[model samples]
Target: MSNADTILVTGGLGYIGSHVVLELMEEGHSVVVFDNGSNASRDVIDSVSRLAAGKGRVDLFEGDITEPAQMDKVFQEYSAISTVIHCAGLKSVAESEREPDLYRAVNVTGTSHLLSAMERAGVKHFIFSSSATVYGNSAILPMLETAPLSPQSQYGKNKVEIEKNLHAWQKKNGGIVVVLRYFNPIGAHKSGLLGDRPKKEAANLLPAILETVSGKRPELTIYGGYNTPDGTGIRDYIHVVDLARGHLQALKYEPDNDGVYIFNLGLGKGYSTQQVVDAFIQETGLTIKQRRGQRREGDVDACYADNTRALQQLNWKPEYQLNDMLSHAWLSHKSSLM
Candidate 1:
């Protein structure tokens, strides 16, 4: 928790990790980033280094998580590491369906490898970047942490498996482990230095909206036009900065009688696909063409979060609303293109 605490952030060059790294540096913590850069670029690291302004140093480890030797090298170099924020995993539902083998190899096997390395290195604190997909197609409107998990995609199943593995690991090791089951994380850092950098084509809505606004893509497709008030699928979209701050707070939490904790990070409000498109148009004053398409293969009707537990436990809550999310995302999008 000190300024000198060497924290290992896997996938630190990615969208979510870069924001979290900035937050960690702001809190005066030293970070070592371990990313394969398969889905990221060296430019992101350069951007982060510039954002840090020499206040924090980021040591990059470019290697796949499935490789044990690569992970071992990180532990060997940074033996003083006390906490790890594991964010290094493939996270596309459509892609996972196309390549289940890759998902199992990276999400499942890669997580196991990281756990083993952390255990061997004596790192106690662990924070897992889990997903809302674990509670797939929930009958509950705003899904709670205790909601029954029925993951619809391989990516969701991977997250469920990882959370279970973390539980088992905690039971044997007696260390503090926090699993943050996040909703749709949108937006970029307010500084415009970090944002979502998808390697392949983006499946998420915000990035697609940005593409439409930037004239890279034409006509945003509104999948499924028979769901809710707007006749489109609704989702809980949390700002990336707020989500990153939640991770920092999770790291600060002490074990509550039990050593493990799980909390959902979201805005506790739902936004339909049409609503998002409308918001983007309103924010950017750009005419975004739209096409009504069929529902995505693994799409769900609606899912937000009962963020009360996160507020109670981690003393964390999102400050940005939908408008703020849209504005910040637009800022990052414009900045990146420039």
Candidate 2:
């Protein structure tokens, strides 16, 4: 009953989490998925099963990290789950604003509950699903991991709070914890078996574009009148598959010299809203009807990443280009219709 090979992934059926689960299974690790079915379902299980090719072990436990009792029961049941890639928690910045308390309760408090369970269970390795929003509004073009911390939204603030708490906990806890601060994650699995077609209304850009093209929405609304080249916000969009591989690399990292390490997971390239639209049209040959809208609160003008650390430390780099991202994304979206 070695704990080293058993991994527990929260929110394992979400967009990014599902891909990571596939990678984990591909790498022959036993995975236990704990999700509340808030934003996911067993639908992804079918995809993972196919992607796994019966090479890895997997199980499911319907639980919430915020509920101590549920979390405790899960830990007791899957005592072999020593390493965790925690992907559960509310993700949308806009949703967080509409419900700040919900953000705090789930993102911050829920993480605390998970930490307690980890300590009690004596789990050693932890990989947190963090966002680039933790960088907030920095004037720096390619933000580094050491940039000043000034989170704008409740979602970003909640991540900062959780990071600070993890710092404190890492002092007493003797294990490796990798906090992956992700940039925009778009696209789908190359196989088109798993993709992000959320049950909720569109909150992300690529999904909005897909929905607009698919006629789910009348049109796509581009946010903000920014002072960028195209008067729209600039973001670093890493293909979801590339981002998924980062987690696998993080899990494989030795981290022998440090207790906690932070890495920015991105493609290290910035693309504006207009640029993305043009690229999408070029890649998919589909027109996205767009209307300009006022800038959403808590969003920065330009935010990319300095991915040097990830490449040097984890031997990870973006292998997919923007074209590859768009093509795969469109294919996945089309496959969903079949």
Candidate 3:
């Protein structure tokens, strides 16, 4: 995609999407934001606009992705849109478990609507925001692109299902679709102008840690304490900005390599929960209370990313480390509290 090409980012006002929008504008690409405002706020658009220095307008459409007519309207207005970074969907695993129907409707059916709309509009270059949850509990320490698919939750199953549908679409139409299987994404934009603002309580570890530091919660609950060296859950936490850059790389991907090309976006290292808590406490010097608890249902003992495919194909590697992730997150959280 060229700097002049208009990129339509679905859910562009959300955590990752907002950052991706900022990155795209920094690269001189015009961005049109398509969000339903279901889980995002309008304040993000104002922040994005201010950050971009008004170089680009965050044209937003407030409508559900499941509505074909709404998506069609977006395509109609922005006919020159050659690329789409699909970041829109219901993402909570617990919520998906509670409402499998809602997950299916938004994730699976919503993706179908976007792809169908793209096909009708003759826009092919697609970047799908997938998750590492598709790997479930893998025996492989660091998951690879070829790892077996075993989703533990409805959210994971929904991502897998959408990936399959995208592959099918690519087969019929000669379109380049890059499915980015992201590991646990943490941290905020370095600017702190944009970050995750979950409508309800957060399920992610970093947010929970921030909440503990902010004193919103009484104590941090260490879910598991009998696994591996740390006796806590380990995850490959990639910075949100790095994950956003990976999407830009995916969009520029060529079409000769058609079908769904999967890349694991991560740092190739895992951090245990206790390790993360220690890092946050050490970095911020905050007295974060903690409690050990039994492992939650469907929680994995450990998981990280091989990340070789992304390095080789996209020439992308995480520039930040665990300390950097913690520090940045602490800074953002502290700023918000102030």
Candidate 4:
């Protein structure tokens, strides 16, 4: 956390990465945002800069993580980069199922390249943006950090493989590696300037809800046939702001020694699809035309998190509840329209 050392954030222009960049800047750490610009906009750099407000400097380096030379060049150019917060990867569940090879190449191999480049550049600390999909549909009530991984989708498999790679890399190189496995992340910055604006297809539930509310989609589809009370899938939806703050906490965490520390970033509570839709309608005072749809492949009936590890270890607790998440998301969505 030295003021002189810059934190390199991969995929810094993406939804989660951009928020993490903001948190880092607000913490008085200069950031080097390295993004491919494939699924992100150059405009995010400007928005982040404005939001940072003279706290810490922000710089963007456009490069593909799959390109070893480009990664090496960025690391070489920014010799002061001491830590890398990795958020780059293809993240669509349906898309991953269709293009498993593509997902593996980018999420797995691209990360391998990034790690090699970091090793070459002598950068030690690392923080990974992992997902709850790694846990799959475990029979356990609340998914624990120690639960056996049984990924249901190629996207989840990619995360599991990446986590393995991270552990191996840390064991070999010996450095601080924090893997933050996020559950269902929703909501947006209160200012409404920065939020999830996917360049490609929208896969997440909240985005689909937003689109339905705005008439971009005809109606919301609730995947049914689950064992929950409403027979709809349940997930632990955490606010994007709180998720970003968890990254900041990870960056600030001082470990006894270098090792791979795993923590689930979630609200530790489950909310069914029907409950979410109902809450959205309640919060926004908007009508959402919706229908029941068959459950998609790789989907679990109910999956939430046992976030006690994160709460005790990182001192990170979700500040926003379901109502706050829905309302803030609605506000950001409306502001985007304006």
TM-score to native of every candidate shown: 0.96, 0.97, 0.95, 0.98
lDDT of 4 by residue, 1-338 (tens): 23468999999999899999998988888899999988878888888889889888789999999999999999878889999999999999989999999999999999999999999998889999999999988999699999999999999999999999999999999999999999999999888888888888689988899988888899999899888888999999999999999999899899898999999999999999999999999887889999999988888888899999999999998899999888888887887789
Tell me which of candidates 2 and 3 scores higher on TM-score.
2
The digit string of per-residue lDDT tens for model 3 on 1-338 reads 22347899999988899989998887777888999888888788887788888575567778789999999999888877989999999988878889999899999999999999999999988999999999988898799989999998889999999999998999988778889999988888777777877766887888888888778899999887546797898899899989999988887766465677889999999888899898888887888889998886656678899999998888886788877777877776666656
Better of 3 and 4 by TM-score: 4
- List the lowest-lDDT window of 10 residues for candidate 3: 329-338
What is the C-alpha local distance difference test score of each model?
Answer: 0.88, 0.89, 0.86, 0.92
Q: Which residue runs of candidate 3 sit more than 4 Å off their true CA positions?
A: 1-4
Q: Write the per-residue lDDT of candidate 1 for residues 1-338, one digit (tens) a residue.
A: 23358888999989999888888877777888999988888787788778878776677778878999899888888777789999999988888999999999999999999999888887878999999999998887789999999998999999999999999999988889999999999999887768987887887899888777677787788897556887898899999999999999998898556577989999999988888889878888888888999877777889899999999989997899989888999888878877
User: On residues 195-292, what C-alpha lDDT tens digit does candidate 2 reach at each position?
Assistant: 88787787889888999999989988998688788889999999998999999999889965758899999999999988988999999777788999
How accurate locally is residue 35 in candidate 1, as Cα lDDT from 0 to 100? Answer: 94
How well does candidate 4 match the true structure in TM-score terms? Answer: 0.98
> Where's the lowest-lDDT run of ten residues in candidate 1?
1-10
Stretches of model 4 off by over 4 angstroms after superposition: 1-3
Residue 256, candidate 1: Cα error in Å is 3.6
Q: Which stretches in model 2 have alpha-carbon errors above 4 Å?
A: 1-4
Error of 2 at 39 (Å): 0.8
